[model samples]
Target: MALKQIWEETNMKIIVKDLSPVLLQTKNVFEVADQKLFRYGHLVLPCLSQNYGPTYFCKLEKIN
Candidate 1:
């Protein structure tokens, strides 16, 4: 999580997998956390730049 924040701060692109299930299963948690952290504060809005890479793969063999 700290690495992710650093990357975001440096304006690097992030590739997160599908989170539909996570969101569906943690709606209450999301709401509570969001309310606590983002209540009247600054936020870093993402930009739609054309330089993002593919989504992160959990298990994929890399060829030498």
Candidate 2:
């Protein structure tokens, strides 16, 4: 199923972390996560990239 459909049906929340101020301010972090989730069924919690720095946390949850 498409990511949007899956998202709507499951009502899953995408959790993002370790985003820099620029990314947060520009909402690029969410764009990255959304693209990743759409292209791939899942994404690595903490991306191993210098841009994102270092962080070890991630969570995907369904709305109750």
TM-score (all chains, Cα) for each model: 0.22, 0.19
- Alpha-carbon lDDT, every model: 0.37, 0.43
* Model 2 stretches astray by more than 4 angstroms: 15-64
TM-score of 1: 0.22
Per-residue lDDT of model 2, residues 1-32, tens digit only: 34467677865665333333444564545333
Over 1-64, each residue of candidate 1 has an lDDT whose tens digit, in order, gives: 5445746676655443433445457454332223234323222223346333322222222222
Cα shift from native, residue 31, model 2 (Å) = 20
**Highest lDDT against the true fold, candidate:** 2
Candidate that scores best on TM-score: 1
Question: Model 1: runs farther than 4 Å from truth?
Answer: 1-15, 32-64
